[model samples]
Target: MGIDLLTIHWIYLIFILLIIVFMICKKDTSLICILGIFVLGVVGTSDFSVAVMGVFNSFVFATEELMGTILIISVITGMSNILLISGINETMIYPFTKIIRTPSLAYWIIGILMMILSWFFWPSPAVALMGAVLLPIALKVGLPRIGVAMAMNLFGHGIALASDLIIQGAPKITADAAGIPVSDVVSASIPLNIVMGVVTTITAFYFLRKDMKNGTLFEEERAVEDIEDKDCIEKNKYKFSKGTRIFFAIVIPLFFAADIVIMYIKKLQGGDATALIGGTACFVLVMISVLTYREKGLEKITSHLIEGFQFGFKIFGAVIPIAAFFYLGDAAFGQIFGEVLPANSQGIVNDIGIALAKAVPINQGVAAITLTTVGAITGLDGSGFSGISLAGSIAKLFSMALGSGIATLTALGQIAAIWVGGGTIVPWAVIPVAAICGIDAFELARRNMKPVLIGLIVTTIVGMFLI
Candidate 1:
């Protein structure tokens, strides 16, 4: 079956290349993306007015598709914020502090908790809160501040943020772009994520131990007396009673645990799973606001929710335009423009994949490596997310050409992009963790580069076999 290419297809290809170049150069792509959308519209409609309207319509469609993700992240962040204010977070982390009698225990436990907390509330809030409570304990038990920062950055933003297992945020974006079910991406990512996580963490730990034992790590290092976050460290602001804080701390975990149980029993993944978590967080937020704020509970809940939504939009504002442009590569193209594509044209991306498959020499190894490289390049902008949609779209194209391995390719790109730019090895992205630990952000990134690269190499090879 021969597939014919159109002008729109060529236009799409050119813009994708341009966007990739922008990302590799660490340039902003919003204007470029908008221009791409408008040009695509102009080409499709051949009418300036309709094309302008199509740009606006595309934004709306992208927002609509992403609303579920936005809501869940916002509500969960709201819940975490409330937990911080009420001082319930202190109780939640207090238990882990007791078990860090050894340096190894301190390293692994802090990282594991960081990964779990990151899954629920994203990395920023977790780092801010956890660094306050656990940083001191970890340091006391012999872990250097840099090592502590590495654990948090790697596990929280690197491992958890990349996979986004329970929240399904990353998977949702990539899957939507790749034109596959979110569950398929999730399932495919599991083994790959585990391999990457294990290899990276263990290798990091080995180097950490060797460095610590050699005393070279502390050669010029000064002792950090305190962190910069005054509110988290010096201030003990608790609005609720100690007993009430303890109660909610226990109840909140139980509720989330129950949500996990329900997810397993009901087979809920992706949006369904997200709905359960979001609903639970909402109830917990309302309940705590009422109990702690009493008469002001209603107003306070609104404030907290506003804060959460602000964080959500701040993180996703750039994502919307990029997503809008990519959505056009899928079915949204027809719905947005009312059949602008030619008859017998299997969607633009699908056709490209088929066309390229016939035109190029593609195998599992080449596809796997290409995805890793593309994913890494996309992540160069420091958002990690700014380019995953591109990775997904490329995965879809390559999958068609190779006749298999879309999920593997998608997961590989996701891991590479995120580990590099999702606050792990990127100098700017590592600042939050570095500040919390009082270490240089660039140094932290340098330390992380070796382990992350080693992990990516091993995982890419593993993906080759699976594909």
Candidate 2:
């Protein structure tokens, strides 16, 4: 495992170049990241046999590590879809619109509401709920599709998912790697989340205002885009009962409450948080199916599970290749791949981080800003969490080389990645929002571009000075 300086890692450089060029050419970041990993393995070993094994090994480890979390997310998401189809989700959101009276209020209200729901239930479920009920009201009140999408993105994915204060998934993952307390990560992330949230939200507002002033578009018409009920066929498939609605109203909260209580009890005894949540979600999935389809319990349960798996695989598959590439940088994964290399080996991503750390001599404050920018760039792939470990690793390197504040730098990077890559500012990420609002995802993204960009810049600057 001796570090070798003499051997030129040409393949590594070429692979990274290809990825950058592809990204520049507007190729999918997921594909480029995957190819980066494949090249990393092939170059590192110079043996097809070993390279093939490395790829498989990396995937196995990555899949195993992410499996529980992914499955939990999928099942809960499917349950949310069920809730929407049953109109329970809409009923839950119906009252909020009554309190929200104006476009501005709608924006903040929707944003904050999504943040709250996503904190416990996650963004995917939160999206379904918000889209079904709150969206229609917001649309009715002249909240633009861009505005609604921005609100959901900021609250659900950006603030809620990034902080992960309740679910603790994102923090747990980062804290485990950093060897820090989950509480520390959570505490640090809260303020950073606020910075990003405020910046993104305000930026979105600014863009909206600019467009409104220019008369380029009308805010009222944003939500007036075609409302296709094709996706709502499920609404007709299942009849909603007042009883069932009440049942769901009680059961959904109860299930989540039970999850929290169980998680707390387990944590008191130092148990696994992810496993607790995952197991609870699985149970909820099963119970919901039984309660909803009491007559054909087994068949209906199988159907729900199938649907859950479909969603799980769709999310997981989209990023598996990306994860595979990032996996190469972690020592745990390197060991799994049986790569007898030092942790600091010049893999494409690592090399870039190391080179930046060495060449850019700067103060801790500026270092933090630089790190955050790098994190944001990496997040362009649209999976915020995918880049956390990389950001963490890079922050550590920068801290060592440039005397940057380690915790502060890491926090900055984490926020940057989760905010941008987590889905708030990206068009590809607004798919569910577009699907629900009956608008083009590209247009939603375009509308968001200015505000999100401004917010990210503001947040990064603030993080540097304050963090």
Query: TM per model?
Result: 0.96, 0.82
Error of 1 at 449 (Å): 0.8
Per-residue accuracy of model 1 over 1-467 as CA lDDT, tens digit each? 32223788888999999999998888999988898889988888788988898889999999998889988889988888778877888788889999987678888999999999898878988997778788888877788888899899989999999999888999999999998899999889999999999999999989998998998676223334555554453125445677877898898999989999999999999999999999999999998878767788899899879988998888888889999999999898888877877777888899888889989999999999999989888888888887888899999999999899999889888889888888988898899999888899999999999999999999999999998
> How much is the lDDT of residue 109 in candidate 2?
92
Where does candidate 1 stray beyond 4 Å?
A: 1-5, 219-237
lDDT for each of the candidates? 0.87, 0.66
TM-score, candidate 1, is: 0.96
State the local distance difference test value for candidate 1. Answer: 0.87
Instruction: For candidate 2, write residues 1-467 as lDDT tens digits.
Output: 23342232344445545644553353666666655666566556666776667667777776776676676666666666566666677666766779887888988999898998887678876776677667767877777766787788777887788777765656654553443455666776667777777777777777676776787757663344334454377566674787778777777777778867876766621126656665666676676666666687568667767877887677666456655555555454456445456555654334544666678766766677776776676566676766565566556556556644566667777777777777765667768877776678888777666666676677667767654
